[model samples]
Target: MGGATSIKVEVYGYSFDNTDLVARQLQSGMLKDPAFTQVTLSRDEYTPEFQMNFDRTKLALNGLTSTTAATAFSAAMSGSVASYYREDGDEYKIRVRYAPEFRTSVEDLENILVTNAAGQQIRMKDLGEVVETLVPPTIERKDRERLITVTGIVAQGAALSDAVAAANKVISETQMPTGISTVIAGDYEDQQDMFSDLLVLIVLMIIL
Candidate 1:
């Protein structure tokens, strides 16, 4: 059997920090409300990432630009097209990338070589350092703004409107920080739009 539509409230903010904060608050509020159940946030888990921080002074001294260092790192870890190969009238890209084993650890990344304008090869570690950090698995955006979706299941005896109203009450009671906003979305928003259109049609018919 197919599943029913879910209730999703989208929280938009200029920055991820604010957006995540508001989303968590909304999720907490929904969970406490009797009208909602199974309240959850659509935020993805953060993953470990290694970021390369280039030392500008070292690059300038070594006769290298930031772009040169970044490109070299990217080529080693990700890949870059070296040339093209044509076989049977089909042209294929010849890309070059480090083997998985060679680029697995921070030490491996630091050992990658970078070429400078003077045709001299320098060790990446000498130019920059790799720092460990955490980043989101995926970033979701709407209308060019960062978005975090809060979702919930309405209780058995509660109507969709009741759930929405309860959510709105929670939102109104919470002190929203600057640059953060919320909108009730999903089936409920669509239903409201449909009803508004129907009302407009009915008014037009009565006028005629």
Candidate 2:
């Protein structure tokens, strides 16, 4: 029982404009980068369901049914919320999705169920397009342009300043599309502001 005890590494903080680009650069082992023991990239993106609103009337005129379209969508990704199943004295979700083999393509998604008010079945493709795309995660309008931010955490024993510097270099050098720009804002700025305020108070007291 005389083995060395465990060691813990603490990271102070980090700053980054593009978390994904940093991840790729780190993965390529470009800068004696620490092997990220654990990485979690957290960012929100707009899903197809939220971006498009189906026009039921338009579908009906085109011999398409809303029920069929919705059903097809549900069938492909998630089936109607099925009842819960109990196992081992605990309850668990029982989502019924199209078997993986059947739901891989846009064709499969388009072919999903479209039941009519008259109890008729139709194909989703007959009415509208079922396109999956990435819209603005959260539209931020600064001078009338959209923006997205990516953020993540680094493991212990990692130098926060080194990471931030590396991230800034990557951001400045990386090529961005015509309308996109990146910015870094997190705990680092907060700490800097707090310290600056504290310094001002200390200097004022000394002068008095």
Candidate 3:
């Protein structure tokens, strides 16, 4: 079977200061190859997500904890299933969720009300803050190693070997920083492994 072009670049840093930069550069370089008809990024550069961090002291003062905070969040944003409604032998789930207006903005989250042990209503902002972050929607990891892959499809009539050559060119030419590494995987890596095994088998057969 023919192999698809795949380039794996693993960038490591305390902060992801260079991860996106390197990924964009690699993708741009691979696309310049004439053999590559198209180049696409698996993860977008800017994917937005919210991270809420709670103050332990404030939480304890309000008789709340991380677990309860999570529950409150889930109930607010994702909704909660209160009960099932059955009518004329038909059943439907009843989920109570916040309206779009009430859950769409940072102000809304800050204004969320969580009850205290004293049965007093407390705003979520009094306990924690929401941090906006641009993170990858999905991150693929193998064997606990974080990886970003640059994949290219070979142009029509281009041989699979051409793709492998392009991959090698990028691997050798790219100047990698400290703690970052590269490895070729997918069909190309598997083909190399198979060829090595075939060579051993032929050598043993001749000896026998």
Identify the candidate with maximal TM-score: 1
**Tens-place lDDT digits, model 3, residues 1-208:** 1654443434433224455566667678878888777766556566766667899999998888878886887688878999999999999999998898997778888888888677888788889897777775566566776666666777778776787778678767777666666665665666788999999999999999
Better of 1 and 2 by TM-score: 1
User: Candidate 2, TM-score vs. the true structure?
Assistant: 0.47
Number of the top lDDT candidate:
1
Better of 1 and 2 by lDDT: 1
What are the clashing pairs of model 2?
Answer: 68-114, 68-115
Rank by TM-score, highest first: 1, 3, 2
Rank candidates by lDDT, best first: 1, 3, 2
**Ten contiguous residues with the weakest lDDT in model 2:** 4-13
Query: What TM-score quantifies how close candidate 1 is to the native fold?
Result: 0.81
Question: lDDT of candidate 1 vs native?
Answer: 0.87
Per-residue lDDT of model 2, residues 77-192, tens digit only: 76665779898999977777788766767777666666666777666666666676655354333344333333334335655565566556655665553434555545445556
RMSD of each: 2.9, 8.8, 4.1
Clashing pairs in 1: none
Model 1 is weakest, by summed lDDT over 10 consecutive residues, at 1-10
Question: CA shift at 152, candidate 3, in angstroms?
Answer: 1.7
Name the lDDT value of residue 54 in candidate 1: 99
